[model samples]
Target: MGTRVSIAVVSVAVTAVALAGCAGEVSDVERAQAKVSASEDAVAEAQDAFDAASDEFCQAGESYIEALDRYGDVLNETAPTVGDVRTAGADLVEPRDDALDSAQAAVDTQADLVSAEQELADARAELAAAEAGPTGTPAPVDTAMPSASPLAPAATVDRVDQAESEFDAALSAVTDDTPLSDASELFNSAAVELEMAWLRLFADAGCLADEQQQQAEAAVRAYTTALQQELTTAGYYTGAVDGIYGPLTVEAVESLQEAQELPVTGTVDKATAEALQAELIALGGVAAQDAVASTAAVQQTLKLTGFWDGPVDGVWTPELTEAVAAFQVELGVEPTGTVDAATIAAFEQAISELQQATPTPSPSSSDG
Candidate 1:
């Protein structure tokens, strides 16, 4: 009887030990799974942050590009002397420096994204290892990280640095009162360099759409034509109204550039374009400028009012002429292709009405 009791006690003890071991194993697995879940959540949060940073960076880059465009406009025009160039460069210094800061921020954000991606990858590996059970080693993680962007990190950094250097060089050239001719070359080089940098950044960041580049190019050409027209109206140019940048056009452009105190490149640069626009505006509002600038403004205004479908390239095609005439009829004005003061006022009124009628969305409504 004593022996049997001892045997029964031993059996109960063995069963309890076995049950405890199983419970401990289950607890370990549960803990590991929880850890993996937490890590996955962290990874998701990091990814979202990275994406937001990337978006901000891209936006900053675009703004910088716009600033550059404005600066380029000023730089490409004719400046009578070194002092004029220096003054123009001074006007752009603040904006150019701001752009540089934005570019640096973008590069920093990109680095942050790379780090976040690495953390996410590490978390995934940990999760995988946890799922492999006791005595199972995790698979080797790939050390060579891959980027979806066309530009590698090293290349991106290099390009950004080069762009900064080029911009600095250009700014220095202007600020130092370099000869207008020499400064023009430096400015052109800087612009080209910065453009290359922007191209790479835009492509890598997935921000530059094919249509955007085309539209930019078209806008530039249109601005050039507008400049030519303004010069012609001012009695500086006698070339054809065609948008070609030929020798005659160059001479005319140089003359205008000299008058406006811009660096003379004989090309329709950003400064030249703006000077022309300002001159046109000063002449008598959008309606009083020579055909191209006037027509372009009217076309843009009409488009804003939902009456024109043509490109705003300063071209007076028959379709545009017809569109203008139709707009005129609607406004109870004479069906002349010319945009007179009455038509201009009517267009402005329509634009104001459209803007006022459009509802401003609430923040809460947009949150979803």
Candidate 2:
């Protein structure tokens, strides 16, 4: 498996690598190197995980096979007193079969991943080699270019705030009777994101001397802590939250993300963080029926307007609200948070009319 690093490259170019262990400074070269290092580490860890998962998957499979052999022995040793007893005994075999199937599937998945990561490591190494050649695009001479992100400061501030909030929540979640394995991992990731954001800010602020090293250290910490928090939040808690992106956290985040139906880059993103936060909140608060219903409705509305997927639990979110406002903008309706009678009536009519016109899976929310 080839490793793909989805790191956001610094548009601002730096001719050389930033010094290590500085508080809040970084160059593009350092950023690139850090990213490559992360990818390499991830591929290595994924290989280890594949090995571990294979062990468990194989062991579980063997256990099931042994159970089947034992069952066969028992069947040969004793005739069932009745047909129902034999049927019940046969039913016991189903769980064993299911276990074996699941284990083998897991083994297959891990085998594929190991291959993919090795391929990626090769591709990246080759790219680095190519970049070294004379024909390669010349490294930019400037490191002072500004970031091109439209939402730079605001986004950074938002990220830092989220990091702090998630940290506090994760702390509480882990300490609570019901440990929040998911939120803990994300909080750590957010912490890393904050560190990354801070370094970017320092670079943008023209911190050239020692801030460079500080920023590099911060980026490492940001990525590492995020990985750690994710691991803890998954049922795979390893160690203390030391704000270091080590091997254990990387493996844990990848596994958790895999379980959560997320991209397995092992890097925590916005959606993953949000889902983790939601999970922690759920652990704290009793999920109300109305909340689930509202979430479903939001999902329905987003899908209707081509923003959301199928599930619509009624929990209102900023995205859902913004989406609803956008829908209202399109429909010439008031952009209120509540889905009032007017909005529903309009949606109902629109969905009915659309479905009536096109008998595809484009049926309205009302139909559901």
Candidate 3:
């Protein structure tokens, strides 16, 4: 009876051990399967995230390209007047800034996609290891896919930067108190730089070459029109504000030259431009109305008679008054600085005497 009881206890112990071993094997399999399932879910989630990131990257790339194209258009716009230049320049600021922002966003989105793809690969590798009982190496992670749009070339980027700078300078030139000619020169120079940039882009995208060239030509014409408009405002140009420098425009230029005592070249030279600007400023006030003609005449007479040493620009300054007083005292007239009929008669008589006393030299005999 004792031997039977001991055998029975040993049998129970063996049965219990077998049951525990089966449960342990089952739990191991379940744990491995759960790990694989979780890894797959993680990989799927990562893939979804990567896909979303790629979409965002592509969208941002498109936005940047659009902004760049708009900026190019602004640079190529025809700004015929100061107002036109100002408006076009103002329009450029927003797109220029947006392009910069979108470029950075695209780069950032690409980075996020790369990271998400890496996470997915890691999860897949984990899943493989889990399934294979951690014995073999997992597959290699794939490289990140290429982006929809290639990165802008360094030269292209540089050109955009230069264009922005030049555009800003051109805007400032017109908005400030810069002279008309100086502003026009600045605009022309900025346009030239912008055209160079556009040409570089056209080299890559030949389809846009003709349009860009036409736009550039238009811009040049606009600058010419601006010059004509400025000259017209100065009362030196009576011709149409057409961009062409025709005979009428040349005649107006000659008129300006004669007024400013410059060489009568009938051309819009730098000196002519400066003179026109000065005349415009002078014409802005009553000084242009010939209202001070009497004062100017007195000053001219005083200067010719060696009494006044001031400009005869029609300003009733204190020096001019003093000069008048001196002339009156010398002529034994009332010392009042004001001019009247008596003063004018005295000045005319003095001028007549001086002219008669001056000996007329015989003209040199011409050689036969």
Candidate 4:
């Protein structure tokens, strides 16, 4: 009976040890399976995203292709007018930009999908190893994220920026002397290169857009108007300030450029604008000097009349403004802080009255 009891106790001890070992193995497998499940969920989400992106890309591409076909059809016309060709070209810009943007999104999502699939495969292998037992060794999976598409590198973006600037410079170089055909060819070629560069940078053809060109032209027109006004003030321009950049304005700009010893680009470049600004400053300084002289004269007159107690300095200080206002009040005129036509007329009358009111000495013979 003692031997049988010892054998039963040993059997119970062996069963407990086996159960513990089984539990540990099951825990490891459960953990690994959970990882695989999560990875699969991630893959499903990535695939959905990729599918949506691809659909958008396809739709955008089709729209752009249709627009391009229409443009080509216009060009293929037997007698396509300049206006027709220009309108067609303008219509193509937005669709092309949208297609490019959609293509970039698709490429990004595809990369994500690829990365997710790799992770899921790795997870599945890990689960298989966990289920195989302690002797099984899983091959290491590369968990590193893939690098970005080479098209979207910083260096490529920089190149695209440079290309855009060059295109702008080319557009600015156009003038009356540039032949229409030559200009068209130059712009068309540059635009193609610029569009391609933008695609590589995962961006739109901003520099090639008609809206951008219109904005630039509007800015230049405004600058030209201001330039014409300045030139007219400086005695260089004799035409009306109609804001139309005609030959007269061009001639005036050239004359000013010659006077300033700048390069004779009739259009107002940076140096030309700076020269005009300098002219404006110089003219303002002369006008300011004249105003100061006039103010000093007025202050002297006011001092003689005993209406002002301040010094005859040309600086129009608060004291000067107050004194002027006070003098205006006494003269039955609106008390404006600065001199105006009405104020000047009142000053003339005051000076006349003060001169007449003065008692002139007879001869002062004894005093002499």
Candidate 5:
């Protein structure tokens, strides 16, 4: 990845946390439950957005997947077309270019929704298991994670997945020659999914100074890529990853718009952009993976200070929670499951402070 995005883990930002005061008072379990629920809501929203973006693709005159599949080559290389007939000297809009942009947006939106759902699913399972068994708090609430919202029930996750499958298959079946109205319907469906997704995330992930900016940027990138990947994965082409903003992207956009029954113009207006962004955000926040990998990572950091004693299996069992609380006690910090920047830095500092520190390893995605 060419982009350099810095994550502002709130736990590490002590001053910021202090100034902000309490975000809310929720038990570790309660917070975890909320995050899961919020995640579920987001995925559902993404599903709707996916449907809308898909509609846009169909409206541009390409109903089948082949239009996206052949996007980069056809639009990037073809001349612009604005009218019905290819006249000897008439000014034309690059139908292919417009089609490509809309198509890519839809693809990226779908992926974000899927990933969010997965993450939430994992988190929810672990939280549920913890709640069912022991009584003592395993770990303090994860203040680091986004707080919960009642509106985003966990059930929505299934809806997004279901919608995605249907939308993708239907979108793929579209052809450039498909009826404009049908294309428009698909685009509208995708938009609906996307819109719902965005609202869910915004509500769940309220504004936190430390991580808020970082989250916003991440939301945009994740959604954009997710939208694009949907088309590419489905077999559409949207030029290079160099971010050139070329005609191929335009064509993909137009194709998607035509499919949605939106204006055939190649531009993505404010309403379109907002709708796409909202859907992406919702999908991005929709799911949680089991805290297993996360558990291991947390345990390793705490063990140096004797905060953890149990095995590191990615599960957030009671033993792990006790270890976390102990670590928090020693650090004079709230022992929530949330790993804010302060907790992370103290963990890092403690490794050196107490010679028991095992050399911390980077995350899987960090190394290569």
Candidate 6:
């Protein structure tokens, strides 16, 4: 009886050990199966994301293509105006950028989908090995997958750049047949482009090692100053010939534009410049313009010396002539009512002497 009881206990112990081992093996296989399910879900989610991104990319690409077509239409128009071309080019910038951004997103999501598919494949292989026991060879995973390639961003960039170049060329192609307002529009467009290009190239710190920025700005400023000078000669601008494009300059430009039957945008454009040149030509060209500016300077100088109280307009009257003659006499120069190089030299010398003779006042002592 004792031997039989011992045998039964040993048998029960062996059965329990076998069951436990079986449970552990089943758990491993179940866990691998669970991993495969999770990987499949991940792949599904990545695929959905890729689909959405692809749709967005397609829409953006279509819109960009339409924008390009519109731009082409504007360029191909017979007798197209400057304003029309400029507006079309401006409109193309946004859609082109949108398409590029969408294409990049689509490429990135495609890469994600590819990666997720690889993970799923690996998980399935692992699950198969787990089900087949320790001696079974795992199925091969597809590791040699193609990488996600970029779609149209590079070609789009090149095409857009070419379009912008062509647009700029079209804007600058001026001829005698171009209308006055259209010519002004071209100038306005070119000036805006130059300003934007300058900001992009030189507005940041350390963009250039030297004074190129200042020189570039000064070049534009020189043009403004010359414009003001011409407007002064035309009896439009009465303000100082400073390079600043102030409200006075705008007002003068508008007045000139209105008189010439051009658009009154208050900007110093090519038409306004031509009108100013015509006015100068009517007044006897560069020589007359210089004389007017010099006369205005002489009038200011006479007012400073208390020899004249007339308005410092560039117009010459008997009052200005008498003032010049008196000033020449005071400076021991010939009493010429007309201003020449000698009169200008004599006035400059007199002013220098006057400045030197002026006394500097000392500060007063404080009482304790």
For all predicted structures, in order, the TM-scores are 0.43, 0.27, 0.34, 0.34, 0.26, 0.37
Using lDDT as the measure, the top candidate is: 6
> Ranking by TM-score, best first?
1, 6, 4, 3, 2, 5
Q: Model 5: runs farther than 4 Å from truth?
A: 1-25, 62-93, 134-368
lDDT of 3: 0.47
Clashing pairs in 1: 73-270, 73-271, 74-271, 77-263, 78-257, 78-262, 78-263, 78-264, 79-262, 79-263
Per-residue lDDT of candidate 4, residues 125-198 (tens digit): 77778887789676555656544343245665565566556545654555555553533423433433344333
lDDT (CA) for every model shown? 0.52, 0.42, 0.47, 0.53, 0.40, 0.53
Question: What would you estimate as the lDDT of candidate 4?
Answer: 0.53
Cα displacement (Å) at residue 197, model 1: 3.5
Model 3, stretches more than 4 Å misplaced? 1-79, 139-150, 175-368
lDDT of 1 by residue, 11-78 (tens): 45445545766756544444444444544454455446556655665666565555554455455455
User: Candidate 6: lDDT over CA atoms?
Assistant: 0.53
Candidate 4 lDDT trough over 10 residues, lowest sum: 359-368
Give the residue spans of candidate 1 off by over 4 A. Answer: 1-26, 80-84, 87-132, 135-160, 175-177, 181-186, 210-368
Give the C-alpha lDDT of model 5: 0.40
Error of 3 at 243 (Å): 29
Model 5: residue 12 alpha-carbon error in angstroms: 17
* Residue range with the least summed lDDT across 10 consecutive positions in model 3: 359-368
Give the local distance difference test score of model 2: 0.42
